[model samples]
Target: MKVAVIGTGYVGLTTAVSLAMNGHQVIGVDLDEAKIVKLRQGISPIYEPGVEGALNQVLNSGALSFTTKLAEAQDADVFFVCVGTPEAADGTADLRYVYSAVAAIEGMQQAAPKRRIVVIKSTVPVGTGDQVAELLSGCPELTVASNPEFLREGSALADALAPSRIVIGAGDPGTSEVVEELYKAVDAPRVVTTRANAELIKYASNAFLATRISFMNELSRLSAALGTDIVTIANGMGLDSRIGPEFLRAGVGYGGSCFPKDTIALLQLAAQNGISLGILEQVRTVNATQPVWFLEQLQPFVPDCRGKRIAVLGLAFKPDTDDIREAPSLAILQALEEKGAAVYAYDPIAADAVRQKFPNVSYTKTAEEAVQGAHAALLITEWKQCVELPWEQLYESMAQPVLLDGRNAWPAQIVKQAGFHYVGVGKS
Candidate 1:
């Protein structure tokens, strides 16, 4: 089947690349002319791991192409809407981008009446598929289906090619079958259901995972007061088959493109439906405060951070990606600046994004330069370079030799042996 993917973002690019590699002719559409130009040159705009190579392969095979106009892919059999639905000011998802994507395709559907099947691969609130169908009610041939993507930022290509599960949500059974046929090449279990169920599944999955992380974070706090090791507690708890090890790692907080927005949007969605999700509300609260918890830990030790230089080891939300959206490093850096501390930050790929946010922040080329001459250092994101820094040289470079492991990336014993005061979350 010929596939047209709207939006050249992470989800769309990965989906287009994966389908093209599977021998489908795919045209990835985006408004950004520069991004389209780069894609045409076999350059991936997104920095997902192992994706650029795959993109080049598909481009070389003449199975994949890109365009800046939606009209270019109007004749395709299937159109996947992968635009972003960022969080609105009122905590709901801003659907303007989604509306625009649908509106552009609605014209094409108007021409032929039953030209193509529109599959929504964006994460949206429940019943959004119905809304799209209603928007293009004039086109009786256009079948709208909800096929929310579950691709992670760094490992997007892997997730797209080998998804854990595939979901097809449509009002008509035929629409569901049509969308499912596009993914017959992908070997994953399929869930065909009502539109609302499929939409809710995407948000609910992220909400539950966020809840588990906050649950462990809450316990990590209690474990600290009782001199109990949270790592061991998580391990013992995960040993039970009912409670898996995923999302059990206690850290600063959950962030990135999904959790923070999805949790709040879910809360707003529940309230709109006259329902209250108390546990999820608490999950959002706990996750928001995790950054401040670092400040609470800092004051007792530093006493006064005025004029002090602090090295921030990482800037991205997680390792292996350049995305800094809702990163804990942002909150940590802002708090440090508020406390009159000079911040020096480093991340292999994410520094450029962080530099725009904090123009005055000392963005260094290497991790060693970031830690050098700093009063103390806080390990924010768990990059491999951060976990395996030359400890002896790092100790010699620091002004105070104080280390705060925010992600608990380093073993306390090793940092102690390197002659630096080490502090970690829920560590006794």
Candidate 2:
């Protein structure tokens, strides 16, 4: 199989690499020349674990290639539109990139003899495939299918090869079968449905997960007031089997390119259809305030943050990826800066991403270096390296031994024994 992947972001690049590794010739197309050049050199533009090695292997094997020219991949058997649909100001998904990709490919189809199945790997609102179908109405050979990606940031390759489900939303029966045949190699559930249903599946999945996390986060506050542990509460409920343990951990909230944008898009989609998703709205509301609430808890430990040197551990949204889009650490860092605190931060791989957004804040190579000479430290990201830091060494470096565990991912008693004031969320 020959696959043409449009866009060189995390989704497109990973898709290209995984396909090439799975005995398919893949050509990744992107508008960015610099990114294309890097990809040709076996250097991934985005940070995903094991992607560089996988890309290098495929590139060396001559199975994977990248090009800035979309017309070059006109003869590919399958074209995956792995572009981005960022959130717009009106709370809807801005699908300009998707439209552009479709338009570009449809135009190419007119000149090419090969008819490729165009699978939309980008996450879009429901009925987006219908929109694509309308756009490609002139080109009958170019069949449109919605195959939304569920790749996590750090585990892109792993998730791509072994996904939870491969939901193909195809308006045409022939198109669905062709798309399924390509994905038959993946050992996961094959969910064949209409284009609209598959689109809703992706949105509904994110919305439900967001609701669960937000519900647990709000409950974590009540748990703290009643001197209860959120972790134990989550465990007790998870053991029920009906409520499986996933995204149930109480934390600063979800922040990346996906959850926040998708939930808002869903809210807008519902409102436009004369429906009110009150629960999802509340989910959004709770998530927006979670970082602020976490920041407010730090006020008691340091009344006046002016001239206070604060260290922030983990700048990435979660961990293992250099992605900081809507990261909790960004909001907390902005608040600390506004309060006139000298902020120092460190992440295993995300410091450069954060540095691009916040140039004034100090960045360090190591967790201990970030905490040195700091009045207080807030552990925002639950990175393995950040969690396994030398607590006693950090205590010795800090001017004041105040530790605010934003994710509540640390053990309090051990830090207390190391002579630090440890405050964990929802843990009394």
Candidate 3:
């Protein structure tokens, strides 16, 4: 298959590279000349494990290329619209980028009529694919399909290469078959359905995952009150087949490009449709207040945050990714600063990016530096470097050996034996 992936952001670039690696000739198209130049030189703009290496490998094999214009990939059998649909002020998905990419594909199809599937890999609302299909109805050779991506941020490349499922949603079987042929080599379950169902699958998956995290977080508050361990509770619950553990761990909250935005978008979508998702509404509430609740745990140790040096470990939303979009650390940091705490933060890869948004928060070169002489250290993200450390050294260096495990990642028993007061989400 000759595929053209439009908008080389995380999703687009990962899709392009993965498709090329799967024995397809792919050309990535984006209007950003600078980004295209970098991609042409086999340099990936975003950070994901093994993506750049795989990109260079495919580029060298002549399986992949990058271009600034869609006409360059005019003969492509599939045009994947992998653009971003950021959240609008009204809490709906902003489809400007998706629409722009679809319009460009329409222009290409009109100029040189040929059989092509305009695959919408971008996450949009339910009827987005139908709207796009109508836009290209004049082009008899062009068809639209909804093939939503389920790539996790840290392991996006791996997820793309071997996804859990391949969803192909189109108005007709011919369009779906054409899109299905592109992923025939990939080993995954196939869900051939209507465009609306496919779109809802993406949103529902994220919304449900967010709900799970928030449910556990809300339960952690109760667990904390009863002096019960949320970690143990999660493990016990995970033993049940129906409640298998995933997103059950209580933490400050979930943040990233997906969960926060998608939950809001889904809620807004439900409202527009005259439906009220009460449980999901509470999910967002629990998540929004989780950081503040976690901070309350700090008061028992640090009576006054004024003039205290607080070490904040992990700034990115999660480990192995530098994306801080809607990251809970931002809220935690703002609250800390408001309390007059001199915040010191450290993240192996995300510090530089976070430094831009928070100029006052001191970024350390290493986790050790962030904890040095700090009154309390908060584990916001469970990066290996942030979680696993020389306990003795950190204990000796800190002015007061107090540990707040926001993610319940640290070994509470070991840290307590090391002469430091440890506080986990629902563990003492």
Write down the lDDT that model 1 would get: 0.89
Regions of candidate 1 where Cα sits further than 4 Å from its true position: none
- Candidate that scores best on TM-score: 3
lDDT of each: 0.89, 0.89, 0.94
* CA RMSD (A), model 2: 1.2
Give TM per candidate: 0.98, 0.98, 0.99
lDDT of 2 by residue, 220-247 (tens): 8898789988888998998888999888
Q: Which candidate is the best by lDDT?
A: 3
Native-referenced Cα lDDT, model 3: 0.94
Write down the lDDT that model 2 would get.
0.89
TM-score of candidate 2 versus the correct structure, residues matched by position = 0.98
Q: Which parts of model 3 have CA positions greater than 4 angstroms off?
A: none
- How far is 292's C-alpha from truth in model 1 (Å)? 1.0
| Candidate that beats the other on lDDT, 1 or 3, i.e. the better one | 3
